[model samples]
Target: MSLKSFGAKIFAKNIRKKIDKWASKPEATQKKVFQELIDKAKDTKFGKDHDFKNIKSYADFSKKVPVRDYEELRFYVDKMVAGEEDVLWPGKPLYYAKTSGTTSGAKYIPLTKDSMPSHINAARNAILCYIAETGNAKFVDGKMIFLQGSPEMEEKNGVKLGRLSGIVAHYVPSYLQKNRMPSWETNCIDDWETKVDAIVEETRNENMSVISGIPSWVQMYFEKLQQKTGKKVGELFPNFDLFIYGGVNYEPYRSKFENLIGRKVDSIELYPASEGFFAFQDKQTEKGMLLQLDSGMFYEFIKADEFFDENPKRLTVGEVEMGVNYVMLVSSNAGLWAYNIGDTVQFTSTNPYRVMVSGRIKHFISAFGEHVIAKEVEEAMQEATAATKARISEFTVAPQITPKNEELPYHEWFIEFEKEPEDLAKFSKTLDESLQKQNSYYFDLIEGKILQPLKISRVPENGFQQYMKSIGKLGGQNKLPRLANDRKIAEVLEKIIKA
Candidate 1:
């Protein structure tokens, strides 16, 4: 083994011990984190506003501070952006993660020095844990590339601001910097298409062992590499083995990726957001990512069905149940207290608190009150593809409340198929049946004839790409929404619809 590989094993051993200690006593670890955050931020503007000094327990904190989304918390965030001292956290934020917001224009999530380690360590430890468990560390010596946002940043109120991925680019550890691929100039290319082409040229002849990025963008890179050199990804980089990804579930894209690589590769899933780095896949054999108990974040979950109730019960980690969809609220070291990040998740394992991102709370189809979430639609697509032996490049779901033909209103699936199914009708039926099985409201609507079985609209090849590019989002750190409540995405899709 190379020296770095050998050192990684030793480092992983130490990190695993810490992981085990916290995982074994998750509730206790969380309680400690909660206490420490309350104590440290007691004198900050937000702490004073919420009476943090007198807060003794979760109940006390909950009573003092109601759940707030980015919009509600922007009042305090604006003060911080104005260069006020200690407006939220103990001191000024180290940086701001500027993310897109629909109703609120743009959101600036604070990243304090205290919270920075959570993002960095979680990413590092995920790799280390893989090394420790699998005893395969050769990838450490070979090139690894994370297709990410540009590292270029701008200044906002004395604080550096950029996309979360871009901000994180500045923090890559010195040890692995030597093995990281795509030259600095290539990464700084603002146009994603140009960047990917540059990256293809830069890394096409190098030794690539690990590739990480959002799956869709990575797929584009893989296709470009194949075009540049007529070889499978695995053949191009025989040592390539590990694939790390976050932002979206990788299952739907797995078949296509495996085909492009010409083999299967071990993958590590991560659940991270601008608000926090919440979880990472610890075991290769496991179904979900393990929550970071000691990440200085206190988690609260409200049942998705009851989330909008006047006073929904906010359950701590100890009270969350396995397999139930919950809207996650977080109080973190970053000064976001009882903050709703808008993602819904389901706990797959309660022992060590493993979770899967089910969907976004607002990214659902409820135009007819069926309320189909992203998870449901994605799974439905999975089932349909499996049954029909169909391959898809991309897809999205939106409710068609008004039909031009005056037919029954129905869900419209805008899909770009990589390989067309022999029997498209059977594929559509399978998609509807799978969705009906998962959501009773949807099943009832179908049975009662309030909604027709979903209609499939073929999107021309590269149509989704064209749509994204048209919206000026054909680049790093952007994700396509799985489902939308209205026809906003569907109408635009119609212009490019093939059949």
Candidate 2:
């Protein structure tokens, strides 16, 4: 091994030690973490308003602070953006991680010095843990290209505004920056297509051994590399061994990625968001990611099925159970108090607390009372693809509730394919059957003729990409919604297909 690889292995060993210590008594460690955050923020404006001084226990804290989504907390965030001091945190945040908004154009989530480590450290440890577990550290010695957003942040009210990946780009350690691919100039190109071309030109001959990014964008990068070199990704970078991905489920794209690489490589899944780095796959044997109990965030869970209830049950880490989906709520050092990040997750194991992302709380189809989530859809697609010997590039589903009065309500799937199946009809039918097997409510609706069999619309190769670019959300953490409560996204997709 090279000197750099040896050094990385040593570093990873140290991180593994810390992880073992934390995992040994997660409940106690998490309780102490919550107490520390409460003590630190008790003097801030938000703390004072919520009477945080006397909040002595989780029960007290939960009673004092109601769970709120981004829109409900916008009032305080606006003050922070307007240069207010101690409005939420102890002082002004270092930067704002902007994300997609519903009614508003965007949301600026605060990233303070205290909270920055949560994002940075968790990412570092994810790689370190993978290395420690697998004993594969040679990838660290060669160039590792991270396909991320522009690092050139915009200034708003004296705060830096950019995507979380962009912010992370600015903080890449000086030593590793030399081994990172694609110059900063190429990375700052705002247009994803132009930026990708620049990246291909710059790194086509570099010593790339590791790559990290969202799966869709990474696939684009690999396709570009293959076109340039006329070889598989593994042939282009013989030393390539690891891929780190997040922001979406990897199951649907796993086979496609393996085909592009021409072999299986080590893959690590992360559950990071603009709000915080929540979890990472720490063990090869475990199916779910181990939650970051020591990250400077206190976690809470609300049963997803009961989230619409007037008085839903809010559970803490100690109260969560295995195999139950819950909407995550967090109280972070970043000044978010009882904030609902809107993602749903289910605990696959609870002894050390491992979870898998289920879906978005608002992104589900229930027009005919056959509520189905992202996890179910993804699993069904995976099964259908396997059964039909097909390869899907991308897909999204929506409820077709506005059909003529004579037509029954049903789910419509818009799909893009890298490889078409031999029998498209079988693919659609298998997908419908898989979904019915996964969801009893959906099966009953079909049996009762309350809903028609699901319909599939084969989109042009770049249909989803065109739709995303048309909406000015071409890249950089922007993902196509897999499921919508209505036909809004599906309608736009239809227009793209027609055009």
Candidate 3:
């Protein structure tokens, strides 16, 4: 073995030992970690304001600080942006991760010195955990490319504003930085297409072993690399064996990715967000990602079905159960107090606390009283694709409210295909059938004639890309919403396809 690979294997073994000890007793470790996080942040501005001094327990914390969304915390965030200190956390934050907001144009989430380690350390540990579990440390020996957002951060007052991935890029460990691909200059290019081309030119000849990014963008990068080399990804980078991805579900793109790579590679999924790095795939045998309980964040869950209730039950890690969808609430050292980040997740295993992201709370379809979430839609699409042997590039669904005195409301699917199925009608039928089988409410709507059967509109190649570009959400961590309550995204897709 090469010296580099030998060193990586030794390093990975050490990390594995640490992880095994840390996660020895999951439940007890989580409770202790949560308490420690609370104690550390209790002296901060938010903690003091919320009477954190007297908050002795999880019950006290929950009762004191009510759950709040981004809009509710905007006042303090505005203060932070205006160069205020200790407004939320102690002193000032290192940077602010700008992200899309549900009720607002944008949200600037704080990234303080206290909270930065969670983002950086958790990401590092994720890879280390995977390496340990699979005994595959050679991935760290060769070049590893991360297709991140622009590293050109804009300064606001004294704070920096940029994508979370870009912010993390600046803090990559010195040792690993040697093997990291894409020059800082290339990553700083604001235009995604231009930056991608630059990245391909720079890294196509490197001894690349690991690639990390959102699957869609990474797919684009792989396609571009293939185009340049006229060879499959495996051939281009013979050592390529690890793919780390997040930002969206990987189910839809699994087949397409396998085909592009020419073989299956060990993969790890992460649940990193602008707010925090929550979880990561640790064990190859485990189905769900292992929650980062020791990360400097306290987590709470509100049952998604009862989230709109006058008073919903809030559960701590100790109280969460398996197989229930819950909207996440976080109290972190970043100064966020009982903040709702708007992502919904379901716990597949409660012993070690492994979770799968169910969907976004705001991104769902419930028109005609048929509540359909991202998980169901994605699974339905997976079934449809498998049954029809179709290859989907990208897709989004929106409710089509029937006109007044018109026939019936229905769901419209805007699908971009890499390879079209032999029969479009059969594909549409299989999709509808799969959804109906999964959601009883949807099945009832169609059976009762309250809604028409779902309709499929074949989007033109790169239709989603053009639409996202038009709306200034083309690249980086921005993801296409899988389901919309209205026709806003649907109309945009239609317009883009027509154009």
Winning model by lDDT: 1
Q: Candidate 3 overall Cα lDDT vs. reference?
A: 0.86
Candidate 3, residues 1-499: lDDT per residue as tens digits?
6676677667778876776675667767667766776777677667778887897877887788889998998888888899888788888889999887766877899998988998998888888777666767777778999989887788998899898998999899998889998898888888888988999999989999999999988988988988899999988889999999998999999888888889999889999988889999988888889887777777899999999999899988878889888999987878888899999999988767889999999889997778799999999889888887888889999988864577688899999998888788888998899899988999999999888888888899888889889888777777888998999998888787777
Q: Least lDDT summed over 10 consecutive residues: which range in candidate 2? A: 97-106
Which candidate order results from sorting by lDDT in descending order?
Answer: 1, 2, 3
Write candidate 2's Cα lDDT for 434-487 as tens digits.
999999999999999999999988899888889889889887788888899888
Q: What's model 2's overall lDDT? A: 0.89
Q: What local lDDT score does residue 207 receive in model 3, on the 0 to 100 scale?
A: 94
Runs of candidate 3 with Cα error greater than 4 angstroms are 403-405
Q: How accurate locally, in lDDT, is each candidate?
A: 0.92, 0.89, 0.86
1-499 per-residue lDDT for model 1 (tens digits): 8998999999998998889889999999999999999999999999999999999998899899999999999999999999998878988999999998989998999999999999999999999889989999999999999999888899987999998988898999998788887878888899889999999999989999999999889989998999899999999999999999999988888878888899999999988789999999998988899999899899999999999899999999999999899999999999999999999999999988999999999999999888899889999989888888888888999888878878999999999888887789999999999999999999999999999999998999888888899888996979899999978888888887733
Residue 323 CA error for candidate 2 (Å)? 1.5
Q: What is the lDDT of residue 10 in candidate 1?
A: 96
Model 2 TM: 0.98
